[model samples]
Target: MSLRADLRVLWRSPGFRRLTWTRLLSQGGDGMFQVGIATAFFFDPTTATSPEQIAVGFAVLLAPFTLVGPFVGPLIDRWQRQRILLVGNLVRLVLAAGIITLVLADAPVWSLYATALLTLSVNRFLLAAMTAGLPQVVPAHQLLAANAVLPTLGTIAASVGGAIGGIATFVVPSVSDNSLAVTALICAGLAFGASSIAATRISRKELGPTHPLEKLDVGAQLRALTAELLEGERYLRARRTPWHALGVMSAQRLLYGLVFVASILASRSILADPDDAEAALGAFSIVLGFAAVGFGLAAVITPMLGDRVSRERWILICLGIGAVGQIVLATAPTAWALLTAAIIVSFAVQGGKIAVDTIVQRDTEDHVRGRAFTLYDMAYNVAFMSSAVVGGLILPDSGWSRPIMLGIAVVYVLVAIVFARTPHEVRPVPPRPVAN
Candidate 1:
């Protein structure tokens, strides 16, 4: 089906539309929240002067939740997902308020980090629930198109949200950190409000594990969760298509993370003033806007491309293109080059991601889908942390290193070759009997 037809089908499905709105708002809020942080840490010379500081900021934001989310994935499968969506958004709303308080008070960095950690931890569950719940809103045949359209739209929403937040820094009359924090608070409120309202539109049981849940003592519950996680791992090992797709996606994300950190450093030190927060933020936002254009184009093209070639082949091609983007960054290392590279890499990443998501959702059983997505999220966040660690060690204080960028480009090319060679046949796994 063409993209337009798929969109028309989706438009007619009220359930899917509600879910999409929920996702779009929350993701956009995420983008705005992140922009606020980027402005504070990367653009503000007082807070973030060196790559070490930059790396540490990310570590603090990501590390704790990364450790906690995998263990919590099974709960998403066990509980009603609609409730998770509703409650999770509320929790984030409360946490966002706390973050605003801390920022306004100029509280200790640890306090701000802790509050942000809780907000993000809840976000992990919300995202897992959203992805897992997708199969419920759309039919089996529409799943591919839904996956391509929904997530791509969500990415664009987020990019727009971030851009809006960036513009707020200039419009608010005061370019202080407090003004950014206020902008973030408003975005968070809008996000939580829209998502919560949308979540209520779906019946509580609509997005389900139609499988029965077992009543167990606390110890038994722990054991069951552990066993279920193991089962998910084994399930992935047995399915060649999803396993290979996930490996390739994970590798790409890891390399992309490296590029991401490099871009931040480059924006702060090379493209704009290291000491001027607003100038630096403006420059970075322009780069982000260019990348958003790429994301929008990818959305339009990926579905059309997927129709012509096998998803695996398309993924391979995206990886190859991504390597070229990295090479551009390595050789040129100018503002325009960075912007151009962002556009190319953004296109490649979104295309590959759409393919990977479809592969995972199509191959996995609904009962375990939440856990599967959680694993995917874990891989995604861990790779991001790895890049931060590597960036901290290797990137110069200026955040510009031709060698590091070139090395990442080489890795991308090699991974693409390996991904192309990997077998992608669908191997069905026998369903294990569920204990009543």
Candidate 2:
């Protein structure tokens, strides 16, 4: 079906519209929230110093999720997803407010970390609910199109939100740490209001796997979840193509994370006044905007290129793009150069992500697909967190190192070569729906 026709169908479906609104509100808030956090971490001269500190921040942000995933999946399956979406957003709203207060009070670092962790945990839960509920609202046939459009829109919303938060820093005090703290508070309010309104638009049970026959006992749910996870692992083992695709994506994320650490260091210590948090944040914001554009372009181009190329070949091409991008950064290492590199690298990473997701959907059975995706999520997060650890050990406080950049380039090229050697017949799969 044509894009316009797909949108028309979505517009007519009240349920889909409500879900889309929910996703947009939540993800948009996420973007702003991230910007606010970045402002505090890298932009604020007071808190910004040392790769180890940055590494700890990254760990606080992502690594604990590895421990949280097993519990999240079982809870997501057993709970009413609509309630999850509503309650999750509400919880995040409170957490955001708490973070803002903590920042204002100049609270201890651990206190801030605790709040951030809880906020992110709720954010992940809300996103999972959004994905699980998607198929419930749209027709099965339109599932593919709905999946593509809604999530992309949500991503765009997030990019816009981040951009707005970045702008807030420039207009507000411009020199005070309180500026970013205020931005975080404003974003928290936006999340609270939008989510509350969106929640009211949908019926409680509209989005569900509502396992009618299952017992609701906690032990039963845990046992079922363990079995399901094991089943997903076995499924991936049997399917080399999807498994390989996942490996490719995981490698890309690790590389991307390393590059990101480099970017942060470069932005914090090299690009602008190291002590001037606002200046560093403003510069970082511009770079982030460029990266978002790259991600947007990837979304646009993937649909156009998906049918024309084999998924395997496309993955190789993206890795090549990344390798080339790293080389560009290595040689120039300026803000503009960083922007240029961000565009290409982000494009490459997002493209690989699209290809891998398509592979999973095409190769996996529908019943176990959710679990498969949960595992997929875990792989990338773990890879990303691992990169922070690796990068922290090797990267300087300034975040710029020629050797590391060169090493990243080499890794990309080698991964591409390894992928090329894998002997899977190339098959084209249409882009599947994704939730951010």
Candidate 3:
């Protein structure tokens, strides 16, 4: 079927529609929340804008999840996913309010970070639940199209939300940075509340674990967590296609993270004056805007080609596109060049991601799917975190390094070649039935 027809079919399903809305709203709130934090933390005039400082900020946000993410999967597998969706957003709603209050009161930076960290940690659960529950909403045959469309839409929603937050920062005349951040946080809290309401529209059992877990004592379940996680790892390793797809996705994320850090630094120092935090934020927002356009294009293009080609082949094509984008930036190192590269690389990364998500969702069993996705998230964050560290060490504060950009391009090309050579034949696992 064509991408349009696939979407039409998906839209006909009530479950798919509700789940999509839930994802869109949740991710939109995430975007707004992140913008508020960025304005307060990274783009603040008082903050030290350095590669090392940026790396540390990323570590502080992501490292906790990396350590705790594995334990989340088993609970997702055991609990009612619908409840997770509802309760998670509700929790974030409260956290968003806390953040707003902190901004208003001039709370300690550590206190603000603590609250934001809690908000994001809950966010991790919400995302994993959505991914794990997706196969339940649509037929297995449409997984690719669903994956292609849903996530891309969510990303676009996030971009829109971020833009709104950015606008909020500048709406008032002579607005203090704290006031601007507070305005954005208020908006974010509203989004989170709306997302929670959307979650309530889906039926309690609509997104499922299929088989209910045998009841276990709290102590027993905690003890079994390690064993279950190990079992999940074993299952994923046994499924070679998903395993290899994940490895490719991780490589793409790592490269993307490196570029991401460079873009931030460049936007702050090279593209705009370092001392003018507002101008730096504006520059960075423009880069993200271009990247959002790329994400939308990938949403359209990936589905169109999905029916015509194997996902593995499409991933290779994406990596090649990424290499081309990086080469452009490496050669030019200008504002227009950076924006152009942002578009191309964003398309490549998001395209590859859609394919990988479909592969992992389609190949893994439903019971173990939650664990599969959590593992996927872990790898995803770890790769990005590692890249931030590497970028910190290698990139100059100006974020213009021909050698590093070229090196990234080379890595993309090599990964494409190596991944294409590897045997990753399309192997469709039979779809499991959803419990009514």
Candidate 4:
């Protein structure tokens, strides 16, 4: 089906529309929250002057959640998904208030980080629930289109939200950095509250594990969770398509993260005056805006080619495109070049992500789908975090390294070649019997 027709079908479904709105509001708030952090923490000349500092900031934000991410999967499977969505946002709303307080009080930085950590941890669960519940709302036949459209739209919403936050910081007269960041956080908190309200519109059990697990004693629950996670690992290993797709996606994300860090440093040190932190922030936001355009293009292009090309083949094509973008960055490390590369590589990453999401959702059973997506999120974040570490170690404060860019381009090509050669078909694993 064409993209328009697929959207028409999905729009008619009340469940899909509600779920989409929930994601948009939630992710939009996430974007605002993150930009506020960047302005207050990262782009601030006093706080982050070196690549190591930037990497540490990301590690503090992401590493804790990545470590504990697996525990969330089983709960997602066991809990009422609608309740998770509703409660998750409410929790974030409360956390945002705490963060705002810390920012205003000029409290210890660790205190601010701690509050942000809790907010992001809840965010992980909320996102996983949305991805797992997608199958329940849309028709089986339209899953691919839904995947292409929904996530792409959500990403665009985030970019728009971030742009708004950036403008908020600049537009308010005579506002301090702390006050501007607080403004963004206030907006984010309101958005989270609104998202929770949207979540209430979806009926309980509308997005489901058709059969939820029974409550258990703490020890028994721990044992069952371990066993279930093992079983999920085995299931994914047995499904070659989703597993391979995940590997390729992770590779791309890793490289993208490297470029991401470079872009930040480049904006701060090379593109804008090093003394002017707000100017650097504006430059980075422009890069993100171009990247958002890439994401939008992928949404339109992926669905248009859905009928003519297999998703697996499309992934390979995207990786190839990413290689070209990386090559462009390596050869010409200018502001315009970075912006052009951002558009190309963001398209590649977003396109490949849409394909990977569809593959995992289509292949995994609902009983374990929550776990599957949690694993997906883990890999995604870990790859990005790892790249930040690597970029910190290898790149200079200026964030321009031709050799590293060329090397990343080479890796992208190699991954595409390896993925194309790998066998995709595997014997299906029967679903494990659920214990009473």
Error at 256, model 1, angstroms:
0.8
Report lDDT (Cα) of residue 111, candidate 1: 88
Best by TM-score: 4
Per-candidate alpha-carbon RMSD to the true structure: 2.6, 5.1, 3.4, 2.1
Q: Output the TM-score of candidate 1.
A: 0.92
Assess every candidate by TM-score: 0.92, 0.84, 0.92, 0.94
Instruction: List clashing residue pairs in candidate 2.
Output: 43-277, 265-399
Candidate 3 colliding pairs: none
lDDT of 3 at 402: 92
Candidate 3, residues 263-317, lDDT tens digits: the string is 9899988789899998998999899889988887888888888768888999999
**Leading candidate by lDDT:** 4
What C-alpha root-mean-square deviation, in Å, does candidate 3 show against the real structure?
3.4
Name model 2 segments beyond 4 Å from true.
1-16, 97-109, 132-149, 163-183, 199-207, 210-215, 421-436
Task: State model 3's lDDT.
Answer: 0.86
Query: In candidate 1, what residue range of length 10 has the lowest lDDT sum?
Result: 211-220
List, residue by residue over 90-188, the lDDT tens digit for candidate 2: 888878788878878899989988888777767776775676567668765455456556767888888877777767767776456576667756765
- lDDT of candidate 3 at residue 241, scale 0 to 100: 84
Give the whole-model CA lDDT for all candidates, comma-separated: 0.80, 0.75, 0.86, 0.87
